[model samples]
Target: MYDFEYVKPGSLDAAKSAIAGAEDGKLMAGGMTLIPTLKQRLASPSDVVDLGGLGDLAGIRKDGNSIVIGAMTRHAEVAASADVKAAIPALADLAEGIGDPQVRNRGTIGGSIANNDPAADYPAALVALGATVRTTKRELAAEDFFTGMFETALEDDEIITEVVFPTAEKAAYAKFPNPASRYAIVGVFVAKGGDGVKVAVTGAGPAVFRVAEMETALSGNFSADALQGISVSADDLNSDIHAGADYRAHLVGVMAQRAVKAAG
Candidate 1:
């Protein structure tokens, strides 16, 4: 990794100030993605503001009907939290299915969502569960947060504080992971909530997206049979050696069906 000035700030304000003062600063949550990029010389930042020292951004709690997770909360913590399991077992299950035990123990939700990796698992859940992302500047709906592949609406200096996920009537996640990396080759998250049904898909395309047709079908039937006649077009999905767009499109249907069944 390239040499860079590192600052572990104890407070959110201090972190923000440190980042703002740098020529080209990057926030480091869990260093899952950033560290790798640095090692490969893919990115070089003038300063790395580590948020690990900020204790406030690391907990799980229930606020009324919603589950609020702090930004620095690790995947393992989310997966093991009694509150998360009781409120949203599917979310806990999704957390448990991340990269691996080591990754889960170190990777933070803020890092995952902020990186906005096309194959990331958290985007599927956030988009499907209709969660709200709270940042240092403002709150953004999940739909508005993720803009495109490896992109988000966050400003350069903005930091995610927490995520708020409303309780779902029924929800589940299913993914066909790339065995070598455990990144989803195609993943689907289905949910029925106050706003009605939502079907968010990840790994198949440049960004996480909702399937309106499947949402409509599932709203009416909420079953695998409801999706029997539906097909997702592969034209816009990712096509690489790992899996062709056509295959990913096919997996979308299969995973969606599995997700619906799991939700039930």
Candidate 2:
């Protein structure tokens, strides 16, 4: 890794100041992705602002009907949180299923959403469960938060503070993962929340996208059978060595069915 100044901020305010004041400073959360990128010389920032010291930025809380997850909270924390399990077990399950124990313990939800890896798992839950991303500057609905691959609505210096996920009637996530990376080749999150039925797809296309057709069908009847008629086209989906667009297209339906069944 290239030489860089490191700052472990004790408070959210300090972390934001460190990021905003520096020329090319980057926030370091779990470092599951960022550290690898730095090692590969993919990103060479002047400073690394570590958020680990900000104890206030970690943990899970129940906010009435919604579950609030702190920005620096790790996947393992989410997976183990009794409040999350009781409220949205599917989301907890999703976190538990993320890249094994080490990755779960190291990866943070804030980091995952900010980075917006195409194959990452959390975005699907965010979108499907109608979660709201609260940041230092403003709150963003998941619908507006994730824009594209490795991108989000956050400005360079902005930092996420909390993620608010509303309770759902039923929800589940299923992913066909790459053996090595444990990234979803095509993951689907299905939810039947009081807000209505929501279906979000990840690990396909350039980013996590909603399957409107499936959502419409599932809305009327939340079942695996409702997903049978719908089929994702291969044209716009991702194509890679582990699985091509065609294969992923098929998995979209299969995974959708699995998610539906799991949600039930």
Candidate 3:
């Protein structure tokens, strides 16, 4: 990794100031993505503002009908949180399925969503559960927050404070993971709540996306049979050595079926 000035700020304001003052600054939540990029010389930030000491950005709480999770909350914490398990077992399950023990111990939800990795798991849950992302600057709906692959609506200096996920009446996640990396080859999250049925897919396309057809079908009958005859076109999905667009598209439906059955 390139030599860089490191600052562990105690407060959000201090972190903001430190980042703003640097020529090229990057926020370090769990260092899951940033550290690897630095080691590979993929990113060369002049300053690394570590948010670890900012205690305010690392907790889980119940807020009315929603579960609010601080951005810095680790995957292991999410997987183990009683509140998370009670409110959204599917979410906890998804967290538990991410990477491995080491990655789960260190990777943060804020880091995961902020990185916006196309194959990341959180985006599917966020979109399916209709969660809201609270940033230092503003709040963005999950749909609006994830703009594209490895991209978000956040400004360069903006920091995610927390994520608010409304409890779903029924929800579940299913994924076909790549054997080596365990990143999702095709993951689907299905939810039925106040917002109605939502089917969000990840790891199959360039970005997490909703399947309107499946959502519509499941809205009438929330079952694996509901997904019958439904199909996802391969036209816009990812195609690589891991899986072809056609296979990924096919897996989308398969995972969605599994998710629906699990949700039931």
Candidate 4:
């Protein structure tokens, strides 16, 4: 890894200030992906602002109809939360299935969402659950939060403080994960709320996106049969060695059906 200064900020303001001060500073959360990039010499930030020391940015709270998760809360915590499991079991299941034991232990929710890997599980949960992403600046609806691959609406120094996922009537997440990496080849989150039905797909596209076609059909008939003729075209999907775009597209349909079935 390239030489860089490390700053362990004590508070939110301190972390923001440290990040804003450096010319090419970057916030370090869990270091699951950032450290690997640094070691590969892909990114060389002048300063690394470590958010781990900020004790305030970690917890799970019930806020009215939503469950609010602090930015720095680790995956394992979310997976193990009694409140989360009881109220939103599908979310807890998503967290429980992320990566492996080590990644679950070290990876933070904020870090995962910020990185926004196309195959990551959190984005699917956020989108379908109609969650709100809270940053140092403002709250962004989950649909508006994800801009594109590895990109978000966040400004340079704005850190994600928390995420608010509304309690849906029913919801579940299904994934066809890569055996080796455990990253979703195609993952879908299905939810039925007062607003109606919503379906979000990740791992198949450049970013997590709502499958409007599927959503409409499912809203009328919440069943595997609802997704019969619905198809995900391969024209704008991610194609890696593990799976091709067409295959991923096909998997999206399959996963969505599974999510609906599992949710019921």
TM-score of each: 0.99, 0.98, 0.99, 0.99
Worst 10 residues of 4 by lDDT: 82-91
Model 1 RMSD in Å is 0.6
Candidate 1 structure quality by residue, lDDT tens digits, 1-264:
789999999999999999889999999999998999999999999899999998899999999999999999999999999999999999999999999999999999999999999999999999999999999999999999999999999999999999999999999999999999999999999999999999999999999999999999999999999999799999999999999999999999999999999999
Q: Alpha carbon lDDT of residue 161, candidate 1?
A: 99
Question: CA shift at 77, candidate 1, in angstroms?
Answer: 0.3
**Each candidate structure's count of clashing pairs:** 0, 0, 0, 0
Cα shift from native, residue 201, model 3 (Å): 0.5
Q: Where does model 4 exceed 4 Å of error?
A: none
TM-score of 3: 0.99
Q: By TM-score, how accurate is candidate 2?
A: 0.98
Candidate 1 vs. true structure, TM-score: 0.99
Per residue, candidate 2 scores C-alpha lDDT tens digits across 101-191 of 9999899999999999999999999999999999999999998999998889999999999999999999999999888988999899999
C-alpha lDDT score of every prediction, in listed order: 0.96, 0.93, 0.96, 0.93
Instruction: Return the clash pairs for model 4, or none.
Output: none
lDDT for 103 in candidate 2 is 92
lDDT of 1 at 10: 91
Off by over 4 Å in 1: none
Model 4 error, position 118 (Å): 0.6
